[model samples]
Target: MKTKKHTILKKSVLIIVTFLILLSLLGQTDLGNFSSQDNSEFNYVTIQKNTIRYLQKGQGKDILLIHGSPGSIEDWNKIIDSLSVDYRVTAFDRLGHGYSSDYEYSHHIEDNAILTNQIIKQFNLKSPLIVGHSYGGSTAAFMAVNDNNSDQKYIILDSPLYEIKMQPIYMTTTLPVLGKGFSLLFSYTISDMFIENGLNDILVSIDTNQRNTIIKQRQHIWSQPKVIFNKSMETKNYNSDLKQISNRYPNLKSHFTIVTTKDTLKTFRKDCEKFHKEIPNSSLIYLENTGHYIQIERPWAVLNIIRQKMEGQPSSYKKQ
Candidate 1:
């Protein structure tokens, strides 16, 4: 009877080991073929212990672009050319994303803000305009609050400035041991599913070339465990970060131009309105029938608003 029990236990262990090995092999094949064709074009800047990857184009007043969660500098690919024509456009892959070194275990918004300020200082950017999208918007706001003495303007595009409810997958990835295991086993697979499912229904309106670029960028980042882990941490602690930002909201010195659409998450729209009400020297623009990816969906609207604000035009999008 003892021999029989031992035999059953050994068989079970063998089956589990076999399953893990197969899963690892599957993950390798499916996640390892990311194309590195566009990597050569990026420039690197060493910030503290990590190297940041960035792209710079054109020459004029500086405009820094910060991308959202699970994103890289390529998020601005569609509008960079046009924006760079009039401004020294610089877009960077935030830590752990794209070509940036994934040395950090946590990617809290405030840390990202500090990194951004470092970039601005390193480049000696003078009175630069910072444009942040989604999660990037949160970082921009935090940077503005902390670096009040810096002459900076901000344009927040469909950002979750106030609060965000964590998604199930993000929550699952925040677990200690289980999180790493899940990321290793399923991050690329989940990313593939998102791509197959049209990537949140926002990519349908984007141009094919731009959409492909964004997908390639996502593929590269999703395959990296550090990036995935950091993203999960961001989601897990997002609310606390917002609360910290809220305390400093009254002291922010930068002017802001907020562009948002009603079709986005309800919490995001509410937060944008709250931000406009609480933060001084800020204006909000509401776009009808648009998606959250306003940068790609309606680049002209964003550029026009930014140009008008920078050129001292009257703020036209004030809430009644």
Candidate 2:
């Protein structure tokens, strides 16, 4: 049995190595060739000791884009150019997502926000505009409400699960049965395919060939032992202090929300609505013909809406 297992491991490693070689040979590792009508480009930024991947593009007023669970920075690739035209745009892979190494302490959003705040401060980004999607949206909200006297505008994009309901992924990450491997082969492949299909469904703009290339690259890169180990250790303890943060939303600076007409919005709609109602300056826009991934689904529309808000227009946020 031991010898057989050893042989299987060797084969797995060999396959991963071959896949990497092919990706390099075919130049399939890039974020994809977005249109050149946009002059700006995304450049990866590394924060030491994080083992994470981030992209910061353009040079102007800052806008940080945060992606959801199990997603990478490419989630915002569709809108980076549009948003970056006026605001410096930054996007990053959350821990356990994509090239970002799942660290021992990054399973939840508190540490993620702290690290991100540090990144902002380190880079000296003046008065950043934060845009968070799903889980990333929650982090940006918490960060905004808690960062007293900070100059950050928050754009929450379809964030659902919060500390109040505590998304069940927390428990699953800690499960003993499935904890041996961060994911079983069946679940792994299923989740991978789910993401690929989700992107196609929501982001109808990306070309099929480039999308396939990115999906294949993701599969090959995650075929490693380190990711599994990190996932195992990342299951315990998250933001126990989100209530206090949520309570202080009225004090946050420049809050905007995208309430996409997607099923995921049902999870925390009551909470988000209550927060928006109480927060004096917060605006929530309902995208009429889009889903949870509205930023990707209608990048141009979101960009225009954000620009209108930034330009201090008398905007109508609700759908007619």
Candidate 3:
């Protein structure tokens, strides 16, 4: 009788697992073809089992453009045309964000940094310039400091989460029973709040219609069980390791971090200011009246700043 009961429990677990998988597939279906609507103003390539939609254009020095959270390659589309003229700029949606494939876990900066390094190697591209915005900025900084041989200069524009670091609330929740419950909550409800509320908070300036469109897409990315599971696991901050990196930077001196047109209340802009001050020979561009999304808001200005960083060209950008 005991053996029969054990067999029943095993069968029940299998059935539950099968249901969960079907639900995941169902969620994907709900997202529909979130791709076709986007005309490939920029081209794309695949990695792993997923597609990495990106715009690769121009020549000269290779530049890898990284977008912020919950954004796709299109986020850089507004500036791609100008950036591509001088440098070979390649910008893509990070894993699990847009059209890119999801990671085993929704890996954060370190995972994305490693992924970028791999892509750089796979394409046989040079160490190239690394330009990142928002979370992408953080990832680019990680790669720049960590990459021993990448011939890369770093451009950080209005990075929202710089190092005003705080431990993620989820880490505390993930402790023993609390953690497992948090895992469940994050995998389900908490992700919804992040999508619904968090997007609104950041893109507060977006008009009603445009904001609604993003919110719809945001909701879709969050609802996926796999994505929620992956992101929830990424609640830790590895910025402390960055201090060691900064100390090694002058030797790793091929990088430049340009903090353009400072956004005072906009998340981590001040941290960029702090970092800019700390690093020797690094200059900060505190452009007046500039917001967090400076690259999209002002492409020529951003490109000019980048040019100065990469080529040591004369810059029209003045000190803040």
- 1-320 per-residue lDDT for model 2 (tens digits): 99999999999999988764553343321222121112234334456555556677677777777776545676777778777767787776666555664435545567778878877876787777677777777777767666654434666777753354434544643555344333443234454564466455554345678667656654544333333323333324334545546667667655565455434333345556666776666776665555566676567766766666566664345331
lDDT of 3 by residue, 1-320 (tens): 99999999999999988765555445444233234235647456666666666667888878888876546666675677777788887877777666566636335577788778777876777867788887787777677667654445778877643343444664644353344334344545566676766666555344688667757766765555434433444434434534535565555454466665544655466667766765554566766554566665566677778777768665457442
Which 10 consecutive residues of model 2 have the lowest summed lDDT?
28-37
Candidate 1 vs 3: which has more lDDT: 1
Please report, in order, the local distance difference test score of every candidate based on alpha carbons.
Answer: 0.74, 0.59, 0.62
If the candidates were sorted by their lDDT against the true structure, best first, what order would they fall in? 1, 3, 2
- List where candidate 1 sits over 4 angstroms from the true fold: 1-40, 195-198, 203-217, 220-223, 265-267, 315-320
> How far is 159's C-alpha from truth in model 3 (Å)?
3.2
Candidate of highest lDDT: 1
TM-score of 3: 0.69
Off by over 4 Å in 3: 1-51, 105-108, 148-151, 160-200, 203-232, 238-251, 315-320
Compare candidates 2 and 3 on lDDT and give the better one: 3
Q: How accurate is candidate 2 locally (lDDT)?
A: 0.59
Candidate 2 Cα deviation (angstroms), residue 267:
7.1
